[model samples]
Target: MSDPDLLAKLFQGDPRSIARSITKVESGSEGAAELMKAVFPRTGNAIVIGITGAPGAGKSSLVDKLALYYKDQGEKVGIVCIDPSSPFSGGAILGDRIRMATLGMDKNVFIRSMATRGNLGGLSRATVDAVSILDAAGFDKVIVETVGVGQDEVEIVKTADVSVVVLVPGMGDDIQAIKAGIMEIGDVFVINKADREGVIRTQKELEALLGLAHRPDMWMPPIVRTVATESKGIEDLSAAITSYFDFQKAETGALKFWSDALGLENVHTEIVEDQKVRVAMLPIGESRIELLEPTSEDSPISKFLEKRGGGIHHIAVEVDDITASLAKLKSQGMRLIDEEPRIGAEGCLVAFVHPAATNGVLLELVQTND
Candidate 1:
């Protein structure tokens, strides 16, 4: 029950610890901060490959086959599939897991389905964190499969060291790739279900688009044809992936470019720090509340209502170093709900500054127990 023991078990690859850790992360539990803090140092070892494409692009099948290929090569694989959350149900469809049934039973393969949960970039953020956990767990390769090519999906794939964009023949919208902003991020393009008619046309169109893009890295993205159902071209697809990995490793320029582009380290640091502060500021209660009242008639809510709109009544911020940040805010002549911080939920320490302090926006600062 102690934090240190729990962290030790988690680092030792205990399944219960792993499951509990993921739950904490998903639910934003108070213990999650300590678990991640302990696990953070062990990460950055796995090869994270992101697979994304529009719906019905055979991405699940491709991921299944690709994972199997890696397994056959004696590599342990971790898969994080991002499924769309149902607006009404507030639950994930779990469609990706259903499609990847065969790989589910394999002990060497770990498949986790994540819901976007109305997070434009939340899914990607969580997916990257999940990948980091898997990486620290010693998975040789981690595959992040995301459904659809929406902006959020593209952002998710950009986090991967190698991003594979999946497309099928006869979609009649290969041009949509440009519009979706997928062309710039793809390290390799896959035409799944290659036996379908117009496969050649789709491949040719992709080539033409790539020709026009003229990447600054000067690495030509390779197109691989795959019949995922039959496992046809799976080898070629794997080879292409391997070749690209080698090329990137050799180029150094490409590796640096992607590292800077993804900025995964910074993201991880920010999230961990943010969560730490949020947890630390929570009071020991079911729901922690920090009330703020207007200091003047032109207070934050009044100004916001008058200028911006009626939506988004207020905003709260979670910071690692509340004292420092608050001091900076106070020095700027900002109004404070309280001159000092107080206890919040889950043993967290919290403080709320009036909206007038933050350009007509309410600001809250939380510090975690860990």
Candidate 2:
């Protein structure tokens, strides 16, 4: 079948299609990159919960119980368990589907077991690809259960939206966690096997350790106790997850631009008559959004305002010399919107190439003054 048909089936929650697509992506198949590109925009919707702890921390049990909790809430759940690869076979050692026998059988749940494949942080790029596929497949919650407190596991957990660290009583896991830098990454802490002898002691120690570190987000990680075997405290765990999600949504702070993604150049708020126009300098090569509310109905950006309200007005590329670039384009018999450069927001010298010349994409070339 073609990719579009396969993609449609995957989106329709066809178990076979999702399993096949995931396998192809995991195996580094020829067209997997294109599939992932189509899947990306559909992601960022599912709540990605990463569970990590030392080996034998009962992470699998906790994941099984927590997934069941989400499933009970009428949510479509996706579970990806990253197991250690055998040095000889390079396959996942513990098949998570076996442990999660009941969940694996549920039509609303999709469970996948992936081998770390000797990749760094125990999370291969394929694992990320699989998670994206599940997210696109309309899973409400995607749980990633990874073993060990190694640097690779920590790195894997860091990619999650909510990182959950599991601990057991009397394991001396506190010291190991600090050593592995797990203290900084955990958004929620769980002391699984809570019915054990030293449950309170472990909780106290975790609280004490948390007191020492100050998070920039200022979110005080909640410590939850769970007895996964008895399905105890699973409700509390689910509640903690919901609470964190609510907190993040209520948080309105400075917009953060990641160093690897985009940079911020300026922030200016303007009032054009009654409506407000906010100019945020995204500084991603040279693309920008312009919002306008003109006194007259015949404003320049009125067409865009009429279409889909408003969004990115044009795509801009940074050029060393706008005049020279435009001259080069004109020599090639290309159509231009403005032959001369003009001043834009934040004093950017810019010129626009007609969308007709750029295959229906408004292309603007810019030269930074400062």
Best by TM-score: 2
Rate residue 362 of model 2 by lDDT: 87
Question: Candidates' lDDT values, in order?
Answer: 0.69, 0.74
lDDT of 1 by residue, 261-318 (tens): 6432211111112222211112223333222222234555446546764454444556
**TM-score of model 1 vs. true structure:** 0.63
lDDT of 2: 0.74
In order of appearance, the predictions have TM-scores of: 0.63, 0.66
